[model samples]
Target: MVGYALALALPNGKFDIAHAARTPGDPVRRRPRGNALRKPAGILVVREADMDELGWYPNVETPEAR
Candidate 1:
């Protein structure tokens, strides 16, 4: 394999969750914080299709957290 992986980071932290992957967070983990992963506490549903549009790609640096 080419050793490609989906990199990601915490919503607010100075840690890199993965390598080769570029994103502040993964679209797959766009669920509510309360439910963690078992449930979605909010109505906001982020699909994998929107990953690129939201800056979840390599070469694209993530903006500083506000």
Candidate 2:
């Protein structure tokens, strides 16, 4: 399973992962359908063990979803 992490640029000038979600695959690679954020940047803070079990990259989406 792959997961998602959100980083928010706030007034306080601090970066944080707001949300996390998981999907089946290495990662969910998706392009915005319309005019959304040009590119979303963030980080994956999950444990290495978790990734080993899931065997996912992070944000790589599948062919059907694309």
What is candidate 2's lDDT per residue for 2-53, written digit by digit as tens? 2232333322222333222332342333212111322235333322234556
Which residue segments of model 1 deviate by more than 4 Å? 1-25, 34-42, 50-66
Compared with the true structure, what per-residue lDDT tens digits does model 1 show for residues 1-66?
Answer: 122222222343222222222323664443333123222232333434445565544655547642
lDDT (Cα atoms) of all candidates against the true structure:
0.33, 0.32
Superposition TM-score, candidate 1 onto the true structure: 0.18
TM-score of the candidate numbered 2? 0.18
Cα displacement (angstroms), candidate 1, residue 13, comes to 22
lDDT of 1: 0.33
Cα RMSD of predicted structure 2: 13.1
Write down the TM-score of every candidate. 0.18, 0.18
